[model samples]
Target: MAQQLDLVDFIAGLPMPAATAPQLNPLDLLPRRPKAWERLVAHVPAEDVRISVSPTWTRVVVEQLREDGCGDQLLGNGKIRSHDVPPDLIWPEPCRLILMTADSAARIHERWCLEEAPGAGMSSTFRFAQQQHADRTPVSQQLRLLAEEQS
Candidate 1:
């Protein structure tokens, strides 16, 4: 009987629980809304791809593409707009959007890895070997050749 009373006393000494604060919608705490570009950056179409590379290799990659005759397909850096892509070209598995910064590239790497579509990407770092060769050609001659090619 004494042990039972001790248990009852212990139970009686415990405080009753209080209610939690009322739930608030998470959106209520937002400081501001996102801009249109900010929203757009979070998503990219599967058909389009992003290539994140250092500026040094970026030039090399662009030059390589130009030599390969895909220069017109290279749109200056931005999300791939429908008008920007060439209608004549058909992308294989994982075609990349051009010229993503290192930071943007990391985010894209993460997103693509999660999707298990690694082939759908390219990084200029992979092409750094192109820069290793010593070119004996003069800058002026290179420029002249580039101009001739453009014409």
Candidate 2:
């Protein structure tokens, strides 16, 4: 007579399935974009300028500046280009504002120095101007900017 195998013995005899790492989708690796309302915008009273600050780019606009009794005049408007950082690693809104303000002030000071004293060199105090965003700004938006920059 043949010996009967118990249930536990039979189960244990089965081969175990190979353990494989989970496959990641290419799209999952892409950065997410933030909604329009999530974007950060701040007004700088010192410069009478408005800026949309983000981790990937910063937009600066001086609506008007009183220079020698000038009214309703455009002082300057331009974009500050920057590299991207992970949204989770970006600075908070208040910090971003402070940095942006410092950068703007530095630029203005540099210009003034250039005009007043030629050959004078001034460097910005805050180099990570673009790595900050308003508090309300979503992380997804920041990530989106990073992805865009990479592309």
Query: Taking the tens digit of each residue's C-alpha lDDT, what string does model 1 give over 93-119?
Result: 333334434443333332232111232
Whole-model Cα lDDT per candidate? 0.33, 0.29
lDDT per residue, candidate 2, 57-109, as tens digits?
33242322222222222222432223433344322122222213333333333
> Which runs in model 2 stand beyond 4 Å of their true positions?
35-151
Provide TM-scores for the models: 0.24, 0.22
Quote the lDDT for 25 in model 1.
33
Q: Residue 106 deviation, candidate 1, in Å?
A: 1.0
Residue pairs clashing in model 2 are none
lDDT computed for candidate 1: 0.33
